[model samples]
Target chain A: MSSLKTPSTFIEGPTRLGKAELAALVAADIPDGAFVNLGIGQPTLVSNYLAPDSGVTLHTENGMLGMGPEAHGDDVDPDLINAGKIPVTELPGASYFHHADSFAMMRGGHLDICVLGAYQVSARGDLANWHTGEPGAIPAVGGAMDLAIGAKDTFVMMTLQTREGQSKLVEACTYPLTGVGCVSRIYTDVAVFLIDRDGDHGGGGDGSVVVRETHGVTFEELEGLVPVPLRRP
Target chain B: MVTITQSALDAVADIPDGATVLIGGFGPAGQPVELIEALVETGTRDLTVVNNNAGNGDVGLAALIGAGRVRKVICSFPRQHDSHQFDAKYRAGEIELELVPQGNLAERIRAAGAGIGAFFTPTGYGTPLAEGKEVREIDGRHYVLELPIRADYALVKAHRADGVGNLTYRKTARNFGPIMAAAATTTIVQVHEVVPTGAMDPEVVVTPGIYVDRVVVVPTAATPRPEEDQ
Candidate 1:
């Protein structure tokens, strides 16, 4: 249980960790041959950190499967890209499919794990990724809904709190819910916490495991990476 | 119509006060900066805006909130960015806000495009979203009623287009532009380049020409940037 107390759970950091540290941390959870969806931003970094020898296969919503991590500078492939339009590398078995079929894979629950970026996440496991309520904003939802529902396990990759000093993990999201009770776990800049699946906030009553701080650092040190000091509800 | 170098007022001259406009983009990406810039200069007020995420501050759709022109906002997540005016107006109840789950909003607009009256989904079952909305159980699972979404004007961005208006979007920035194009009465597109007819591959055309009404070329504009991509 003490080893679980890793300091930062984010993909990027000022800590400038070695690539092996990053890959080892992520690869520990990724089972062999797990089908995973990598979200656009920081979540995408996980692909690069996935251990090379692991059997993890990455699926991109934009229609690539068996994707490998980012290529070294000499090996960058210009034509192959991820949903973020960033040039990436593909594993030997990488396959391309029609966009429709790709979406079907997402909506039909074929994905085993999906790491997402969120604006807010409730303690009840609701996700709010789309829209933030200002005027002249772009009005649309990307493929987030399909992944939230279709993935066998939904994990959120975000700071535990918002830049405005608000906790993303809440009793209930004030914003609209992306998926009701779909979140399985949360990885933040500070620590890793699993949702209390059992209905009890204390971790044992319902089936939900209580999330404890993994790293030995101060909550402020964790918050500094995420840019928000989280207060649990 | 007189052409001025970046004529601010002339751009939005046709958009009347109190008109409901749907702007395209997922987050801050693919927003019609030209139209928004023009809307700001034209001093139009009392507009109902629909979009994904509001622009942060002094950018994107959030700029309208900063200008205090939006009367109402129909969106999903409106509290992500820190906009003083958005927070102030929302707290004071100065603006009417209707929040729909992200998927529901997309499907509603897609339904509008297909001319389907409404489609049922299980997104908001047994929750606040199911409140007030009609619900029906299908095979033991709950479903919620979602109405189609249509806007008076749709503003979009594209990487390339033809004279007749087939569109191609830069990757990532191609979030809501094509969908909003189908859900609006009049669709205006801002493009980086307009190529000769038949230049763009038919297979690559994202939005067909039938949905586009007007084209506004952004001269010397680089590719549209998706805020989340970088």
Candidate 2:
């Protein structure tokens, strides 16, 4: 039993890191030449920091493929936008098509990574991003369910805690579920954690996803790097 | 216990003609009949109704078609009931039909809820669905980004509810209710029954009250005719 106990591993961030640094943490783990989806909110920041030299292709559910990060003011294309209605820049090789095919790719499991914003993430990596019913807010769920289930790997970006001081990471989600057993990892302000499935709770699958604390380094700095001596505790 | 009132009807009482409503259903399977009946009884007209399918001719959402309330329908399939009014209207072009693939319909609704301006996919690529749309390719795969679809009003059904308006559907009926709940500017629910908080099994509750704005409880009549029965 003593041998079974593992020490909790923590990725320490520098005192404080902004959104860009956090996004780079997410972008760093993505491999070269991958098909990716950048969801609304923090997930969108990833494109801005993806290694300009990497051959990664970004797909927007709205219809743009090979989307580049945000463009300079002079480079903005009026017709180029993400799911969030934010204007975006297209890569040199980017192309557009009817929106139907975009979702098909999502549902078809052709994506390598899809980064999304989450309202809560369960320990098992379940995501809930659709509706919190905030006052006067539109009650919409969007493509959260499809993305959560369709994407090959679902990575979530969110704060460790809510404004009211509630932890977004829970043993189980109180919100409506987008996809069952679909979350892969979580990137939060405090730290990054891989949702492990091997705990004694006896769920399905081994916990293979890796989570590390981003103590403040940019994803650019962390990409291609894994902890030298991973502490399983 | 949650109690529904006639006052709930007030919400749809003033809808003007030529309204575009996003109704929930893949036919009688999940359509909200009480609300459709309310719309038909209210005599609202020229409605461009968006749904997964038109309901059986005389039951479910088809009641609106029977009453000549739906001026058009944007959906994937039509209920096969021989008496379906929407089908006749659609065939005569008396009602415009904008057919979307089932998955596409769900995605467009979700896209609107996510606040996405537009997106592309290969589902409708190279087909009529691609006409008049920009085409793009990435990594040798072609795709088309679609604009999100939003509706002025969305009407849905729930099996049970609480005073706070959280909801849960019986089973597979949970289907498009959750999606439609998120894509509308104003969301109203017609519940078969209203229950007290904590009475429903949290595990079974599908739609949370947060997305629901208004709800009305009326005793549900007999089940709508199923497509298989037709």
Candidate 3:
């Protein structure tokens, strides 16, 4: 249980991490040599920090593996792109498949990890990322639902709070769920959430959410923000 | 051997009104813009179309949607920064949308082509996307029953094709071409070039000739990179 605790030397202050710093934090946590999918938006920034030779294979749901960094100048190939539709380069040993086989890699548990951007994550690790379930909003579910449910582990990278200062971590996701109990860890600007799936992480021997790390705020402040029952690490 | 034509319009001239069409591409990477433009010229209407995105900008799929041809769209991601045509029509209640999870959409299309009646998948289980679907628990995990999504025609794009229609794609542009080719009753491909029957290396053929019905040489200008269009 002690290993689950936030290190005593962790920096906690009013100065928060910039988006790049947060991305680097998430990038540092990904296991070396793992096959990972980085979702569009903020999660895509995590790719910049990953070394090309880290043995980390990037999977784009549009049908590619071993995706390299963003293409520049003459290296840009419209045919070679990431899930975001931006032109990119292919690393050595890159392979391509059709949409079906690409999704199969995720759904069949062939992918090691997938990083997604979330609107809300529940105490039970429920994910709500695809749609806002709004009246006027156009719903686009891209590969979020698949990435959330299919990958071996799902990690969410987002800001800790809404612009209105509301916590993203809640007791239950009000938005339509992308997957049920699929999130394993969440890396945010303010904290790293370790979700205990059916008492797997010793989160007080229950499937509770634990705060493994915190920055820009105190543990008490973080607890006051989230609506879920939290086990302070 | 497949019928090879030099005209994009001639290639898609037989796609009648009110047909179910599967348009290949992930965004615009592999979208057969020439074939879609020809479909517009045919003045087709009341179509049920399936693709990854709804449309982007005022061209290709967007142009067809703007021309009031599509009655329904079954796709995973329909809303994007440049999806004005789909957004305007959808908000005005002029179109029907069935939003499937990406994985479910792909597998359903694959199942339709592979002759599978239905299969259980864990992709959208326990989410709102699984509404009215049957869920089964196998080995302590839940999966929902998903049906196939077959189509009357498929419009695809590939880098090159042999005389008999063996296809080879370029990079990620190969996204949905092969699967859509198999999932449709008639598959029409628009390629930049048509080579001799034995020209293309057999080992590199992404989509076999059996799944393809027709091929057209669009004579694209040396694979020029288009503007930054997502």
Candidate number with greatest lDDT? 3
Model 1 ranges off by over 4 Å: A1-26, A31-35, A38-45, A52-110, A116-147, A156-233, B1-11, B82-85, B222-230
Q: What ranges in model 3 sit over 4 Å off?
A: A1-14, A204-207, B221-230
Which 10 residues in a row give candidate 2 chain B its minimum summed lDDT? B221-230
Task: For each candidate, report what fraction of the true interface contacts it reproduces.
Answer: 0.05, 0.01, 0.80
Q: How do the residues B1-230 of candidate 1 rate in per-residue lDDT, one tens digit apiece?
A: 11212342454568878888888754554667776767777787998888765555566577787788889888765655344557677777777777676557666777787799987777656555558888898896567888988888888877788877898876435656777888888887878778888898999888889998777777655323332242
Per-residue lDDT tens digits of candidate 3, residues A1-233?
11122333444546577889988988887778988999787888999999766789899999999888889999988788888888899988999999999999999988888889889998888999888888999998988888898888888988889999888888889999999988888888888888887576666546567777788888878888888777765
**Could you tell me which 10 consecutive residues in candidate 2 chain A have the lowest summed lDDT?**
A224-233
- Could you give the interface RMSD of each candidate, to one decimal? 6.3, 17.7, 2.4
CA lDDT, candidate 1, residue B111: 76
lDDT tens per residue, model 2, B1-230: 22345444575776669887888754454567777777877888989888766666586577888777888777755534343586577656677767664556877887886788887765455434456889899886566677777888888876778877788764334556777777887788887788877887777666777778788876653456443221
lDDT of 3 by residue, B32-104 (tens): 8888989999999999999999987788998999999999999999998888999999999999999998888
Model 1 chain A lowest lDDT segment of ten:
A1-10
Best by TM-score: 3
Docking class of 1: incorrect
Instruction: List lDDT for all candidates, in order.
Output: 0.66, 0.66, 0.87
lDDT of 1 at A86: 61
